[model samples]
Each structure stands twice: as C-alpha cells, then as structure tokens.
Target: MIAIRSSVAQLALLFLAAAGNGALFVIILRLRFVMEQHLKWLEQTYPAGHVSARGEQWYNRPFLVRSLFQFMLFLAAFLSLILLIATAWTHRGEVFGTMPQDPALTYYEEHAARLADGYETLSLETAHPALLKLIDEHFEGETLAILDVGAGTGRDASWFAAHGHRIVAVEPSEAMQTIGKHLHPSPDIEWRLDSLPELADTSASGETFDLIVLSAVWMHVKPDDRQQALETLVSLLKPGGRIYLTLRIGPSEPERGIYRVSEEALNTQLAELSLEAKKLDEQSDLLGRSNIHWVSIGICAATD
Candidate 1:
C-alpha cells in the first residue's frame, strides 16, 4: 500500500510539472510565431526597394532558406524548453529559489593560475594613457591613497604601490586574491575581499580614498546595481577625490559573464548619482579585439 502511495505521489508531481511546462511551451511557441509573421509582414510591406541597403540583404534570402531557418529556430526553441524543464525538475530545490551561481567568481576560481600568469606578462606600458594622464592631473599630491576595486591579480594595485601610493586592492574571488597576493607582495598594497553593488566589508572599515580606479571592472556591474554602486563608491571617496572607470563596450564575455556597457548609459547613471564627469575618452580595444572597444571616464564626487 505504501509503495503504491509513493508511486502515485511521484506521478502527481510529474503531471504538475508537465502542466507548467505545457503552458510555458505554448507561450513560447506563440511568441515565436508572432515574431515570424511580423517579420514576414514587414518584408512584404516594405518590398526590396523600400528597405534600407543594409536591411535589403536580410529580406533577399531564398524562400527555401528562410523556411529552413524558421524550422531550425523552432527546433532549437523546442529542445531548449525541454532541457529547461528537465533540468528544473532534476534540481528543483536548488534552481527554483536559490541564488544563481556567479560566472565571474567561477571563472576566476577555475582559471586563477592562467589569469595570474597573463597578468604577470602584461606591462604597465599598455595601460590606458588617458587614465594615467587624468590621474596625474587631478591627483596633484606626491602620494595618494588609492582604491583598486576588482583588483584581479593586483596588476594595477602593484603599479600604484610602486609609484609610492598607499593601495587598497578589493577583490572578491579568493583564488584571484591568492594569486594577486603571491605575485604583488607589497607592504603598501593591502588586499581585501569585497564586491559591489555594495562593498559591505570595505565600507565597514570606514576608510576612504583620494583616488579609486575600476579598470575593466565596471562592465561586471549590472543595470539595476549601477545607482547603488555609484552611491557606495561616492560615499567612500574623500573630498575632491576622483574616480577612473574603464568599461568595455560590446557583447558580453560569455565565460566571465561580463555585461556590455556603453558610455552614454554610464554617463546617465553617473548623472543620476550626482557624480561630475570630468572626462570621457573612447579608445580601440587594447587586446586587438576588432568587435570590442573601450570607454574611459573620469568622475568626481559631487561636493555640495
């Protein structure tokens, strides 16, 4: 009797899960169909000549090719839905409500050695010249207290420390921090494990800095967290302090889970935070990635 009850309960759960998946599948299929029909309508409405030169090519695909594309898209979507449902049911407890794994942390932890070696090989000579120049102009003092947020491998932190500045290198990944400490063993540079939207640990210490550098780090910050992050960083800035941000603009790095960022979007976020933008410079990707570009901005903590 107990065995029969257990089997019945399992069947009920499966049925419930299937029911949920059925609704989702139908919704997804409808959306796909609507999008396809809309695109087809647009093609017919505009015709080839009316379409822009760039868009004309898209509409010029052979009928068979277009049909094949649609079929492939539908098949992909169907398989994705099945996989999502199966995976969720297999790990329901962990997937339904638990926090998602952070890809950046995972990447750093898994590739710590390789990343450290890469950082070691990189020369400060290739550093963004505009950032360096702006730091020099704004920070007139001989020695400044600097905060290197997301200081992976401590490359920039070591550079700042070597230049006679007190450095606080904030890195959240233990593996990355370990490599950084090993590579840049400097008394002037202190390594701390803290992350943003909120630098809770770093903020608890009540320490502020004259200069804060977030190089290749701002892209990791999500859209919703931008304002809070700006506020937190602003609060940690000393009077007349400056911030240097270097953001990568392009598609996300799939492995690292870094998001694409734009200068205009960042400028808007900064304006909302009341931070004064001192400079915004655009540069080609330093690593020779043709699709990627860099935007460096210098901001000041608003003084009221």
Candidate 2:
C-alpha cells in the first residue's frame, strides 16, 4: 500500500539524516586533527633543519597539497549534507514543515473555556500519586528551572512558580496563552509562544532546565515528529534533570483531534533518546473521563 511505502521512506530518510550528521561531525574533528598535524609538520621541517635540499624544496613548495586536502575534506562533508538534503526531499511528505497545524490547537482555541472549567484544578496536587512521589523524592529542597510544554492555561506552571521554581511556559495557541496570562499572573512564569518538534526560541536561549513537564501534550505530535520532539525535550534538560510526561491513552476524541499514542511506543522512543526511566505508572483518568487512561512516566538523563 502507498501508506506503507511512505512510512518506510520516512524511516529511511531519518536514518540517512542521522548518519549524515554523524559523518559531518566526525569529519570536522578529523579536519582539526589534520590542521594540527600540518602545522606540526611545517614547524619540524622549516625550523628544525630536518630535511635535505630536495625535501626542503618539496616542503616549501606551493601550498597546493594542503589546499587540496582541505578541499577534499570539505567536499566530503558537502556531499554528505547533499545526500541528507536529497533524502529529505524524497520524503517530503512527512517533513515537519509540510505537516498541517495540529487540530488540537484549533480545538483548544475554540473550547478554552470548556477545557479550563474541566481541568483548572488539575495540578501537582491532583497529579498521579506516583509522579508526585517521585518529584518529592528527587527534588525535595532544590529550586528548579521548569519547562512546561503545552502548558494549557498555566495550571501546572502556576503551581511550580508558586512553589518557588522559575518556569518557562510554552503554548502555541494564542487563546490558551492569553487565558493563562490572565488566570495566572505570576512574575516567576515566563510565557513564550513555542511548540514541539522544535522549540526554536527556547533552543536559541541556550539554557537548559531542571524539570520539564509535558502533561497530555505528546499526542498532538505526529508519529514522525515524536522522536524529534523527545530529542528536543531531552536536549533542554540539565544533566540529572527530570522529565515527567503524562500520556492520554485510548482513541483520539473528536474534540481533541490528536494522534493516538501507545505506552510501548513511548518507552521504545525514550530508550532511543537515551533517557533513563525512573518510574512509569498507568492509571485511570483522574478527570472522570471513563473512556480515557493515562500513562505517567518519570525519566531523566543518566548521570555518572
């Protein structure tokens, strides 16, 4: 089927991209080593009088050989990047830029009041007990830099900020961000317009956080973007910092209109992202949605 082919193509392109980036990084390190070696060779030959007349002539000859070597190194890196771009072009259907805006954004924008009414009280107090326990055990007395992705109406971010943690709340929907700003007017919470797969502004800041929370947000990310979103979140974490994720299970609701996510898939992706799981718990929906289940996972970067 065409769908199956497209999936395969997308996966292949992802692999190519990973390999190309790795190759480029290795080549750059090698390039640096080559430069050091060339400089050392020049010093030994020109100043140390270690060469015969013919050898000195060769050593002092035009810098064409070094230039050629440098050119070849750059050419290899260029070719690998070109290959990555070509692979991306061939699988453009799943490209993040080409995907449509998440329907959940529209849903939340249209029904912000309904969502707020139903979930406003849901914060660290009402969170899954296991996750709360983990938070208490690990971050007992430390003030943290917290990142709340898809921080709907600033419910959780408000709690963290109130508890003396600095917070960055990211929400792409203007409606939700506006409501959050109005509802939770806290100087500790910095509001930013950003979203997953790439948190451009956050990434640009070059600051990592001590805690990152994604409460019922990952499902909005498409399957192709899941890995990248995880990677981005992990990159934003300081070493030994934790990420608490709450995944809503079961079918996608017509109102939410987001992709379905599985616990198995999440664990697999977390392993691929090199995150170490501290705890994982499945619980019935606390909001009295009978049709819904939740998976709460606590994970962190491995520390030596």
Candidate 3:
C-alpha cells in the first residue's frame, strides 16, 4: 500500500529529473549550433587573414578560443549537475524525509492474519528473555505505564497488560490492529493507529510512559529519520524511564522495506540525546535462519 506509493513517487522524481536534464542538454546543443552558424557567417563575410580595427585577426584563433571556452563551461556544468544528482540520490531519505507510504506497513497489512497467528505461536519467554530480564530487574513489582510501538497483533502489549501494566499499543497497519484487537481484547491495553519517526497521535495525547518497547521494529526506519524518531521516543518517556529495543541484524529484505540496523548508529544517536544504552543480550535468529540475528539494547533516561 504505502510501498507502492513511495515507489511511484520516486519514479516520478526520476522521470522529471531525467526530462529536465534532457531538455537542458538539447538547449545547450541548439545554442552551440546557432553560435557555429553565426561564426560561419562571420568567417565568410571576413577573409581568414582579415584583422579588426584593434589589430587582432578576425577568424580562426578567437573563434576557436571562444568555442573551446563555451564547450568547457557546458561540460563542467553537465558534470556538476550529474554529481549533484548523485549526491541527492545517495541521501534521498534525508532529502525527502518519510515516504508517502511505508513499505513495512504495506507488508504488515498484507500479512496481518498469518503474522498474527505466527506471532501468537511464539513464546515470549523464548523470544525475548533478555528484555524480560531487564524489565523484571528495573520495573519489577510496579504497575508501570508502557508504550509498545509497532505492537503488531498486540502480542507484547497483551502480555504486559496481563502482568499488571497499563499499555498503549501503537500500530500503523489497520489490518494488524484489527487482528490484534480481536485476538487480545484486554481492558488494560489501549490500541492506537500510529507510527514511528513521528507517532503523531501518540505524541498528541500528552502521555508519558515508564517503558517504551520497540520489538523487531527499528530496521523499518530509514537511517536519516532515526535521530528524529529516537528524539520523539525520548520525549514520550517519563523521567528515569527506559526504552527497550530489539534490533534485527542481517541482510535486509528490500521487498519488506527492511534496512540494515546499525548498533553503532544507534549508540551515536543515544549519545547525541544525552542518553546511554547498554547491550542486554545477543542471540541467533529464533526462526532458525542461519544468516540472521538479534541484539537487544536498553537505554535508561537520566532522572534529573
């Protein structure tokens, strides 16, 4: 859904860029042709060895020099335009910000039913032991407020709600949220249609939480938007609150709009926010794929 829109937008931009460049190239060639025709007329009107009133030869040298300079200037401009396009393309995520639609949301919308069942089958104890341990250690015996971003099917949200926590489950995909609501009809868990790098609705509610969970969700965010996303998440946290993230590490599924997650980049962003993160645990892929893995991280907020 969202992915298709993003692709179309990108294609449109590419087409416009190519068309503009082509038009510019044609105009330059036309100008060159006119200049050549004018020069030819001047040459025929004035003999080769004719000198101007300033005592300079009228034909060969001056014409060649001027033509060479124009050619060089056009060539430089063309090359510079190419370079500029390349740079913009490389940083398109930053330049364009969030896409009109997110591919990951589309994937979830398409696979909501199957994903809900599969997610329900996985045991939380096995799937997220490290996060559970950190939660117990930091927030044990307390009925804390929790924000579960990307809470597809409400699996984690249900678990937290059952454990005496108030939960706000934010899922952007309407399909996923529908299935999630049907599966886990809990009074303690509040569901909202929202998404990351913004979470505009959640932010607008003026709610703060003790714990924010992003389970298998960060990789879907573009690198350029991660900083803003992190800041938004931090803003939703209460003083001394913590954020728990499970980062998927491996080759990305471009079809699913997954990007490679970088721990170093996450750490850098944390530092910029005056926060500190610690590695909670690292584990092989639970789905038994040989090439994939997960790293769990915990970021604690300063209690000033």
Residue pairs in steric clash, candidate 3?
none
Deviation from native of the Cα of residue 31 in model 3, angstroms: 66
Instruction: Report how far residue 277 has shifted in candidate 3, in Å.
Output: 0.7
Top model number, TM-score? 3
Off by over 4 Å in 1: 1-100, 302-304
For residues 135-161, write the lDDT of model 1, one tens digit per residue: 778766558989999999998898889
Model 2: residues with Cα > 4 Å off, grouped in runs: 1-99, 302-304
What's the CA error at residue 16 for candidate 1, in Å?
34
Return whichever of 1 and 2 wins on lDDT: 2
> TM-score, each model?
0.65, 0.65, 0.67
| Per-residue accuracy of model 3 over 193-240 as CA lDDT, tens digit each | 888899999999999999999999999998889999999999999987
- Sorted on lDDT, best first, the list reads 3, 2, 1
Residue 92 displacement (Å), model 1: 18
Model 1, position 41: C-alpha lDDT score: 89
lDDT for 67 in candidate 3 is 60
Where does candidate 1 clash, by residue pair? none
lDDT of each: 0.77, 0.78, 0.83
